[model samples]
Target: MENRIHLGDCIDVLHEIQENSVDLVYLDPPFFTGKRQASSNKDGSKKYTYEDRWHSNSDYYDFIEKRLTLCRKVMKDTASIFFHCDRNAVHIARYALDKVFGPEAFQSEIIWSYKRWSNAKKGLLQQHQNILFYSKTNSFKWNKTFVDYSATTNIDQILQRRKRDDRGKSAYLRDKEGNVVLEATKEGVPLGDVWDIPYLNPKAKERTGYPTQKPILLLERIIALTTDEGDIVLDPFCGSGTTPVAANMLNRKYIGIDKSIDAVHLTNDRLLSPIKSESNLLKKGVESFLKKDQWIEMHLTGLECNPVHRNSGADALLKEKVNGNGVFIKVQKQEEKLNDALNKLVKLINSREGFKGILIQTSNTDEFINNESKSIKIIKSISMQIREF
Candidate 1:
């Protein structure tokens, strides 16, 4: 099998991996939901109980620092990592990451902005999550992926202004141009720190049972823009396995680790039976199978009705028709349609002796199913009573 799941604590499992083996790492660790659940009375809302216990600042820092140190060991010198978190612990995680990976390796602090409910009634709405990107080397691979940033007409036009250089190269115009004119290239605009992807709502199709699961598209953009095919992808806290699935679908090898058994199972199922929307260009064949609506039907005729017939026509049909294997040959215009087509085919096979069957279909059929009986199997397409010897 090309894919396999390893169940254990992320920190312990990460230590077992070879040093400098991974090409990319993307992690979405648990956010520190500080001690306090707001309770609403008739008058107003007030903070009451704590939903999570790991609220102490020191405890939170230590939990992340240890995992990050182990993660650093498994990453290649040229590899890059994206650490995802919310406002609760993003600042702390950033500090820890800088310490482990070094300040000079700091790449980008991506702000994933989304439209969601914010409790900041007294202050500006909290509609964004933070993702700190880091690399082991300064010469790491970087591909600038872009998305349509047009919220309104004016904002779009202002952002859409193209710039080029004298050698017909597309780049941000740095200096004033003389008489030399440059041609605009087709390459899209460079990505910025602030990303505006749609938030996971109740109606979202990608919403699994997990409460904080992210969209596959977000991970896809990150993986595609940063790494190439056949590179290794690592996800230390792989929640529902979104990172691994995205990496595999993009033709990249992956290793995902999660402490939760449920998370591991969720990831396994997601990778095996990924939704159609998450299907990438490489999985076009799988998508085609799901969308197939037509079924193959085979018809056979002209066999002498005898208790023990050798190499007979009815025997041919029995040999070819099997369940779930795509072989659908049947007796042509047989009034004795025994209960179902399947049973009839079985009966024909049992009555015939030394009858060798052949498959007759207009199109090539995948060997999905095969039967021991040597009989004919035909695929159905049109309705016509034709005779066969």
Candidate 2:
């Protein structure tokens, strides 16, 4: 199949394609949220929007069903289809998918969990979306992907071989002499349905002013799971062309269809460069990013503050701001001199306008600098106070 973007309704495009030719089909249809989804570019100079409004629930279901049927027609027998949606439409969308692909072909209901914060509504924060994975036949292709095991996983489980007991329960394998048997090799834990990818923050370089634009990392995972080199991938609602970009990156040919002309142009431009934002949080585990001074956290326990990580100068920020500015705090390292800590704090104070700061001196130093010139105030750490007293 040729790699290209088709303009117009996805149903028409899918119909024009030959039957059972595509290897993988992925679609992120509108969620029927009863409103238009609009977002502006980084500088707010341009806007991209899509209307999700529907006359009624039945009308929306029918619309999705027709497109899903068309998508099924184009999928090869060994193909897989991933339909992405949220709570607002997951139920109906799954119903339609089940109708097109037999219920037995329904593979997995993947939870694309992410971290999002919103205080406008009084309820549990919305933090995840769903993707329904279905296949055209029982022999659908699936590439095994393994991820790092969670902290709680037992080492023995990862290293030792296992066997089913007579009662059909899992048990560690043993040799004829009753010695514990170990596996010759191991693949890391199989990737699970529930994912924890970080959402695209406001400053993500991949953002293209398109509403509901998924991260390329998310698409990369899906594409890797279902397709291989030289495989064909399809995205019926290719908003910002994330799927196409991911497909191209993974060495697969892709066909992206979208009704919006601007979306097509944006997708083409992305295909030319394929700029993907590297997520530090995803690259390094969350535990690695959360590494900070435990002693500093203990000292600030009585105060309402949040610990800062991955910064050169600041250690924490007081929840209470001073003079319409964030109050930055830094703890002097045990080996650091008092003057050096003060200098670090001073640099941060000067860099951020309207911000005030404090430095906690943890160790005694022979050299001292007058605090009058600097905006940062110097305070003694509790240990220092006890030693001085």
Candidate 3:
């Protein structure tokens, strides 16, 4: 599974995959969006769009029921699936999923709220989409994502006004020995089901021309928080191949499928040109150009959190020799400031006997030395973004 796109119907393609192979599944299947045949080509050439149609509720259930059964077969015991849909077919889809994957496997229904351009007088604006998450087994991976609290929420103001304890931290009352014990606030609050992440607007850097294409950030968050690196991700209804693109960027192996030949070609073209910045949605497409080995190297240093070392030897080496994705130098106790740490790390990397490169995670701008500093090159981590020379 070294970055290849499959062209065919999802059910047929999924049947070819081995059982219990995929780690995660994120699908945004065609909603019964009645109009299937639209002018697809840029020059107004005639093109047929694959439309999902159902005459009755049972027909829709039958359609989803068979596909979900196949999806379950391909998923590992610990694998999870996210089905994105709207109100039109969500209930039937849920019923089919429950029958196929079991009710116990039902997870959260993520509400993706966004703005729509419609008159308010006629009816309430439909501004949210639904995503149903399901796991194959009880023992599954779930890394909770910490979304930043909205600025408009009153909770922020309430939190700010709370009194502080002697340690200068926000106070929370505790009941102990019939006395109130004030403690500091926890790191952050749990994210709720009603996510306020806006839909991909026209000006958004990640916007691809695909009408139903989702933001890469949403997929990235799901993939990162749900599974470990090197896990296999599958997207059967891979419209424009966003799931595979996100999986590759996050160092996950992936399988993507689509019935539309135009979509397949569009996805292929999108993956081929890695340097062109079309939009924020397309930035994740850059991962398509990276080889598995290159992805490994980038994953080692580029990820926000500490990279999950594959081997115990690598873990030991990292723990003993590296600090924050870089080989650390024992700077003087007083010289541990940002600038000094950068200089010491750079000097150590340059002085090393046989290392090819060094990645320094620091806030200082002086992390990089001249390129001519022997065979070693510098990589600096400013916040979560990494830059290499």
Candidate 4:
């Protein structure tokens, strides 16, 4: 059935759907962690558990293969599937997918990378999971997606047209006069196989405490990449209903099948009103968090302070407060007048009734002028003092 959540085994559920009807399938099945995976709600008032343990590796392989074959039957010839798993089961999962979808149908192995603070058990800490992508055929639907170029990319690489030289080496294309030719505006780089999407935090509003629940943003990317609006998306092992919610938000029809009634109810509840966590890291770019440049760091060296980002008035906050309030630190820019920098620090400190400000004068402009205010203090930078000496 279209846009429905069935509470039953996925294999039996797949039989009811018409052949070649689904456009996309995204499944986050058990990762074969031989334990009772259990977790609870934010307040610990409610708990959920799922069985991922199998009698043997062969039994687990058989279980996965049968469902994968059924899933393939429901997919259209132009459809695609994204199977999500972690290191524990990645090898077995890949083998099953290759056997069912054929080696030729295999696409990319997307690595979903994230950061977590935890003690390492033995070797390297686990920081990534894998999603094996497969197309039902060579003609599968694909929507091209692009991401912004890296911060270190050279400007010439983006703006200059290139050609193969007589030696077959890539060089900038030039006119007969030997002037480099400029190309049209370029779009950002294509989406890569390594995704840096963040994992759901413990306090995230989207967190449902499903032991293996996935972030909705991850599913949204997959749905947007492979299918268009009104396309049918199926999640045979929908745990927290992330896929159905994502599909609905993207204006696509969805079918979610889960054997657990609790999971089915949770997915249905989420469908009524879906909430996605906004990621500042993705919105502002990773470089935005790095506020202190070499100049700021060198000037504030050996000082106990916290560097501030995305703020114009102050560069840092001193660890040692004055009069029970924060001390704002602003390092004068090389091209800025000393008065102009002092005014910015004054404006911010005045806004906070008890706060004080420190202006590290790095420039020589207005060195002899009285620029200190009642709540603001002026100090010469170490370099400035050395140059004057």
Candidate 5:
């Protein structure tokens, strides 16, 4: 079945499908946490759960092995599977996957890492989960993907051609004339096994409050990496239907199976209208977020304002509203002309009605302007006042 969710045990549901019909399978099976994982809907109207508790580790292994065998039967020779789990059962799951898919089929052990605010019990915080990738055969489908290099990457490493020296060590290639050789133009760095995708926050639009629900972005990456448009994607343990929704967004056919009736109904309802949250962390690099201006921050310390990043017109916004409108603040730079700074602030304040603007003058090198309006206020910085005296 295409673009449908079946309400039954995955083993039984998978049996009805023909062999070698699916292109991709992504399963987030129970982690054998010995707890009945439960959560409520966004508005607390409904609760959804599934039993992850098993009799023993052997029972868990048996359960996973049987379903994986059935999943393999339905996957095409060029199909792939991604099995998601956490520390509670990754070892046992890996052993089971090796037994069912064979050692040659193993591809990667992807580590999905994210940030966590706090941890009560202390050793090292748990910030990552494992996704074991395997293919039905060696000729599985693949689509090349690339990402920007890290902020710490050396510029020379990217632009210079490298070769192995006599000792087999990496070295920059040089011509017979002793001139260094430049590398050919290149695409970005290839995708790595350790992913830094964020976990779903509480107010994420796609979050259905189902326990252990994954972010749509995470599923989208997995689907895009292995399948093409119009290809079939299957998720046997499709909690909250993230996989199917991701497949739908990418224009691929999808099949989802869950034993919980509520999960099946929720998955269907979500398909009617799917929502995805925008992640600032993914859109902008972490280095950008941490790239705060220390001088600007020091000047606005006692002003009770929020610092704005990458905005040409404003440096910060006042915490308190004036007459039900926001107050945008701009800190004048040492070399910038006074009128030029005023023009930038004026343009922003004029775009909206009732909003006010403040310009903090940090230098006296520019000519004084007598063009302050009712909506625009100009005040000298403490440094400027000290310089004047």
Candidate 6:
């Protein structure tokens, strides 16, 4: 089927689609944020917006339920639906979703976390949205994906074999002589429920001057996780056609429905030449912060290690490990003392991130303290050693 966007009330459009033909449905409807959601082009030459305000909470819930019910009608038995919403009416959305898809089919409540700069407000700054994942049935299609290991993962121990003892405790499998058994090679960790995707910035090349437009990367992940190539993905509330763009990029057929004439035109315009903003965060994974940190690069000279930037206490993640935990490295600053540097490193490792690190001795000191956890390995700098001699 050709990828296209339909214009009309989503509930009305969904009724026209062939039943049991859609493989996946992703929707990002109005969040009931009690205001008119609006955005404009980078130069402020164009603007787009939509109303999310309602007469009452009952009105909002009823509107959500009506569309959700129709969405379920067109989906195949093995299809899955991802409903995206904000905290304002997430409970209403979730309740309606459970009623339509059944609580037994609930797969996950995925949190889409992103960083944004907001002006000072009386309340806490909102940073996350909810995406309820539910399959039409238990036998839904799912494409398993793996993400890179965390900064403090026990890289070595991940490949080791383990067995349960008589007491039902998990321990490493050992031979008669007590040698640990090794398992076959494995991929990285499985994708988690929480996703850290960036919001569409005004400067982003993919931004289409559309209100509440989500990053294509976010839709790409949802499309990749549930549908394979050539699968039919449906989006009843496709704003600016993000779902269709993502589906088409992945070689999947898509049907997008929107009530606004402008939305349909923009979707068609984008599909003709689907431009995606490449995310450094996704390309480099979580480790991208490490590679981008100039401070870590300057300090970790001559050492082949991955610089970890997410963890504030740790500096460089050495390409090695001990006792199954990753090895990390921290260099003392010019104004910082040896103990202060070591304390920061120790605290990070003890946080159960499963990491070990070392304090690079860069100054003269009479203090010699031992890390009780044995996670920090100190390496004296050549300048300090020469001064001592």
The regions of model 2 sitting more than 4 angstroms off are 164-171, 293-299, 307-315, 321-326, 330-355, 360-375, 378-389
Q: Could you tell which candidate, 1 or 2, scores higher by TM-score?
A: 2
Model 4 / residue 232 / CA error / Å: 0.7
Worst 10 residues of 3 by lDDT: 308-317
Model 1, C-alpha of 382: deviation from truth (Å): 54
- Give lDDT tens digits, candidate 6, residues 147-208: 87888989889878999999999999998999998877767889999999988767789999
Q: Between candidates 1 and 6, which one is better according to lDDT? A: 6
Q: What local lDDT score does residue 322 receive in model 1, on the 0 to 100 scale? A: 39
Q: Which parts of model 1 are misplaced by more than 4 Å? A: 35-52, 117-123, 146-186, 276-389
Backbone clash pairs for candidate 6 read none
In the range 185-262, model 5's lDDT, one tens digit per residue, is 767799999999988877778799999999999999999999999999999999889999999999999999999998
Error of 6 at 262 (Å): 0.7
Q: TM-score of each candidate?
A: 0.59, 0.86, 0.61, 0.77, 0.76, 0.75
Identify the leading candidate in terms of TM-score.
Answer: 2
C-alpha lDDT score of every prediction, in listed order:
0.66, 0.87, 0.66, 0.90, 0.90, 0.85
Q: Which window of 10 residues has the lowest lDDT sum in candidate 2? A: 289-298
Tell me the spans in candidate 4 whose CA falls farther than 4 Å from its real position.
Answer: 292-389
Q: Give the TM-score of candidate 4.
A: 0.77
Distance from true location, Cα of 385 in model 3, Å = 45
Per-residue CA lDDT of model 1 for 191-243, tens digit only, reads 78987666655545565656477878778878997899998889987877888
> Which residue pairs in candidate 3 collide?
205-279, 205-280, 206-280, 206-281
Worst 10 residues of 1 by lDDT: 303-312
- Local error of candidate 4 at residue 62 (angstroms): 0.6
